[model samples]
Target: MSTGQGRLIIVVTVCVAMLLAILPMPDWARPFRPPWVTLVLIYWAIALPHRVGVGSGFVAGIVLDVLTGALLGQHALAMSVVVFIAIQLHQRIRVFPFWQQSLGILVLLIVEHLFGLWITGATRGTAPALQYWAGPFIGALLWPWTFVTLRKVRRHFKVT
Candidate 1:
């Protein structure tokens, strides 16, 4: 796709992701709410490394931070790390089967969650419970579908 069209798609997807990030959940399900922005970032970084990287991640995170009303840089720091790791392994991970790519996404989500927890603990407080750790698994479980849908979007937009 043309660079302008590719960028528009990115903006649209990121806006949708930001909306998902702040949407409220029931108390019982709140902890399972996956990091939507992070998942989107992971997919884009892998699919089009040239267009999505640390800077995109940081900008996405800051937008997320604003959306969620969290301390500035919380998502920024975590997402920057997540993007770095994804970019580092994208060459290898992209060749893996879907299932294997999902596994890689699982690891990346877990690491992102841990970084978020550490930052939370340092800046405010963290909940020490399985619930706090559950989002990654849910995110992993959703990765296959997420990847498939995003791949379709990329193809439809003819993004490079």
Candidate 2:
């Protein structure tokens, strides 16, 4: 594929992820909503660190903040940190088995949430309920399937 095509595929995937992030859910299911944008950014950061690193993460996070009506730069800082870590460890992570890779993803997701939580607490002077932490766990559980699916997409489109 041409360079522009490859970039377009990545952008499209991220846009879909952002949509998923903002999709409506029943109140009971809201806390369980996986961090879709974070997961997509993680996949790309791991698969193509050079092409999608901290800048992509920051931009994705900013868009996500706007889409979700979240505090500005909240997701941006969190995502930049998460993607930086992923880029730093992508070589080792790429060699891991799926299960181990998921574990790594779990760590990254937690880190992202930590930053978010800190920002929330700082802004609102209140802590979220325990359920606030559930999304990362769910995201970790979904990592294997996400990884496989995105891998197939990348291969199909010859995204490099």
Winning candidate number (lDDT):
2
**Candidate 2, TM-score vs. the true structure?**
0.99
Q: Lowest summed-lDDT stretch of 10 residues in model 1?
A: 121-130
Each model's Cα RMSD = 1.2, 0.6
Which 10-residue window in model 2 sums to the lowest lDDT? 15-24
Write down the lDDT of every candidate, Cα atoms only: 0.88, 0.94
lDDT of 2 by residue, 40-121 (tens): 9999999998799899999999999999999999999999999999999999999999989999999999999999889999
